[model samples]
Target: MISWIYLGIAVLFEITVAFSAGNAQGFTRLWWTIATLVSGAIATFFLSLALLDFDVGVGYAIWTSVAGVGIVVLGAVFFQERLNLRKLSGIALVIGGVIGLRLSGAA
Candidate 1:
């Protein structure tokens, strides 16, 4: 239970790092670049904690899926990125897969 919490936090931080990376402008922006690096390290640390109990494959899949979905939504909202039907359908598939993975007791 607690491990899942850690995993969730890890996913959030990973998304933060990824979001900031875009604004980092190829690491030219000092603040955003530093934010990216710091958040990435924090995310990795939390993931390590999660891996202590969870299966690596399962944990990693959940982490990436959650972060990927979050980043996509954030991109659409914050960056004014387009969200066409195909992209939305893809997100739905990823969400479905995540739910399936969870229900299968893969994590």
Candidate 2:
């Protein structure tokens, strides 16, 4: 569970890559890419540790959807992102889709 939290940290840095992509140039782009890749690798390692009790396939499946939902919530609350009607509706859909995927054993 703690290592899963570290994965979330890496996801936040990955989001930083997204934010930097448009504005960062040449070497900066390369650096951000490196940062994203390294963090992602470390995150995966930790996630594996956290999932020792879980099946690899299912653990990854659940991680993807649940972390996705966590990201949106974090963006809205911590990032002070505006939750417009359309955005809120989209978030609703994401939540619904995640729920469907998890419960249907598709995740």
Candidate 3:
């Protein structure tokens, strides 16, 4: 349970990293660049903590999948990015994959 919490935190930070990196404009923006780096470090740290209780492969897969989905949705909602049917389908597939991984009893 605690590990899942850590994983969730890591996912949020990873999402922050994505947005920050974009806002950094190739690292030319000082605050956004710093935010990108800091969020990435925090995300990795929490991911490592989660990995202490989870299988590495499973943990990493879940982390990336969830964070990817999160970024897509957030991009649409906050960044005015496109959210068309194709992307929606991909999101569904990724979600299904995550569920499959969780059910495999390997995490």
Cα error of candidate 1 at position 30, Å: 1.7
Regions of candidate 2 where Cα sits further than 4 Å from its true position: 1-28, 78-107
lDDT against the true structure, each candidate = 0.90, 0.60, 0.92
Looking at model 2, residue 80 earns an lDDT score of: 95
Per residue, candidate 2 scores C-alpha lDDT tens digits across 1-107 of: 46556545545544554444434555366766576566556656656664765467655655665555565677788889776887667667766875685578654
Write the residue-wise lDDT of candidate 1 on 53-104 in tens digits. 8899888888887899888888899889898998898799988987887788
What's the distance in Å from true for residue 17, model 2? Answer: 7.3
Give the Cα error of residue 80 in candidate 2, in Å. 4.9
- The residue pairs that clash in candidate 2, if any, are none
Best by TM-score: 3
Please give the lDDT score at residue 25 for candidate 2. 57
In terms of lDDT, the poorest run of 10 residues in model 1 is 98-107
RMSD of 2: 4.6
* TM-score for predicted model 1 compared with the true structure: 0.88
